[model samples]
Target: MRADRLISILMMLQMEGRMTAAELARRLEVSERTIYRDMDALSISGVPVYADPGVGGGFVLPANYKMTIGGLTTAEIQAVFMHLAGGSFEQLGIGPPLRSALLKLLHALPDQSRRDAEWIQQRIYLDPESWSQDEKTAPYLQAAQQAIWEQHAVTMTYTSREGHELCLKLKPYGLVAKAGVWFLVGETEGNVRAFRLLRIDSLEGKQEERFVRPEDFDLQVFWQEWLEKYESR
Candidate 1:
């Protein structure tokens, strides 16, 4: 548990740049003394974590310093690959990278950890498709994903449920995969709408400065509410 706690502190300082001991202790639910001790442990372990002094001072990692994930236990190694093997990575375009990463980790892991991982791999499997339905194809799904990552708008051509060809410029927010279908959630004409990715005939990302995402938008909350209204109809 202390290993996980120390890693958490390391990650927090790495991402947040500077955090007061009080803040770290509060978030980590430990005492300030414990946070300081953990900081020392991290420093001794060769993690470049250091503390600032006086007003607005805390702990920070160097801006350019980063460490790759290593020292994985059997359970950790298993957990990392379970979801990648569960059948969505290909459509999301991350399958190859995940496979390469798994191979790298497997090659470096202890023999027992590798054996445990291989045993689980041979035993447990996952497929997300439904037996009764055909898998839907979304040729533009990757482009939509790109637009979301780029924080840009896209001009998209799609057929509506009523079967009309229409075009709209959408501020792409996120993509959701349900069963075997993908949905593009975006803001268009001052309203957020979910467009079935299969129906989108084309998508062209805007080549402009990054669009500002709304401050209050929460994708998880929005998706859950969307599902409620969608399934009710």
Candidate 2:
């Protein structure tokens, strides 16, 4: 645990440039004396960490200093890849980036750890799709995802379950994938709604007409509340 705490402290200083001993201690949930000892340990261990005395002084790393992904344990490396393998990132049209990142992580590992990680990948598997169900495809899923990421309004031609067609302008909030189905959650006419991705006949993102998202809007909370209300009815 001390090793982890020391690493975390280094990371904090790396990102923050400079931090007081009190600040570092508070962030690490340790005492100021412990922080001082940790700084001494880092300096002795060949890490370029130094403290400045007096006001506005704390630990500071060189401006150009950067930490590599090297210090990860073998088990940590395996866990990272395993979690990545469990996600449906590919279906969300981010397969290329995900694969690129995995390759980078793999390449960063030492030879022995790389082989161990590969072994773990070969032994454990993750299939995000549900069993014995027809594969669901949403033609507009990627567009909706992009719209949400860019905070843009989109004009969508949607058909309700009752077989009525409606064309509406929506301020895309987020996208949710459930049971192999994708849903687009957004705002239209001051009301938040969720539309089935499959039901969207056409989608055109209006990038020039962006809407400000509410500061308190949270995708997970919104999705949960919507699911609760839908299920209750």
Candidate 3:
């Protein structure tokens, strides 16, 4: 447990540049004194960790220092690469970038870990589409993703299940991809609703208006509750 905590501390400092002992303790769920001891251990072990005392002072590494993936075990490498094989990035329009990142991670691994990851990738297949069904991304998916990311309200020309065409102003809270289909979860006229991406005939002026996301909203929890309610019916 201490070993993992030490690695996490090193990673936090490396990524954040500088952090106070109190901040590290709060993030790591430990006491401030423990953070001081851990910092000492890192410095003594040739990690080049340093601390500055006083207000606005904290722990930092030299800007030129770089951390490597040498600490990862074989199982850890396999787990990471296996997740990459699951194939959700393609629907998000980032398949090429995801492949590039996988190659970089493979190159960074040790020889045996690289081999294990490759072997796992070959054996584990994630086919999200159903057999005999032609699955394709929704036409307005990219637009909805952009609107959700930028916190913009979109005017959508949508086709309802009963074949009615309606215009809606949507404050997009999040986008969910399930089993190769995408849904936009958001609010329409003060009522929370989910819009199937495929039902949108067109989207207009995604960035023309912006809205703040509610602080109390959580996508995963909301989805789970929705699933429970749907299943109970």
Highest TM-score scorer:
3
Tell me the tens digit of each residue's lDDT in model 1 across 1-233: 99889878878887888999988998899999999899889899898888789898988899999866656677777787686685566788887898898898778777887888888899888777657544545789899899898898899899998999989999998988876678999999999989999888888989593687896788888999999998998
**Residue 222 error for model 1, in Å?**
3.2
- Tell me the whole-model lDDT of each prediction, alpha carbons only: 0.84, 0.85, 0.83
Q: What tens digits encode model 2's per-residue C-alpha lDDT throughout 1-233?
A: 88988899888988888999888987788999999998888889988988778888888988877888678887787778877884458878788899998988888887888888888888988777766444456788788888888898999999998999999999999888775677899999999999988788899989999878897888898999999998897
What is model 3's C-alpha RMSD? 4.1
TM-score of 3: 0.73
| Number of backbone clashes in candidate 1 | 0
Question: If the candidates were sorted by their TM-score against the true structure, best first, what order would they fall in?
Answer: 3, 1, 2
Q: Estimate the TM-score for candidate 2.
A: 0.67
On lDDT, the candidate that comes out on top is 2
> Which lDDT tens digits does candidate 3 get at residues 122-185?
8877776556344575777777888888999989888987899989998989887767777789
| TM-scores for every candidate against the unseen true structure | 0.71, 0.67, 0.73
Residue 198 of model 2 has an lDDT of 79
Residue pairs that clash (backbone atoms under 3 angstroms), model 3: none
How many pairs in model 2 have backbone atoms within 3 A of each other, for residues 3 or more apart or on separate chains, i.e. clashes? 0
Collision count for each candidate, in order: 0, 0, 0
Cα RMSD (Å) per model? 4.4, 5.4, 4.1
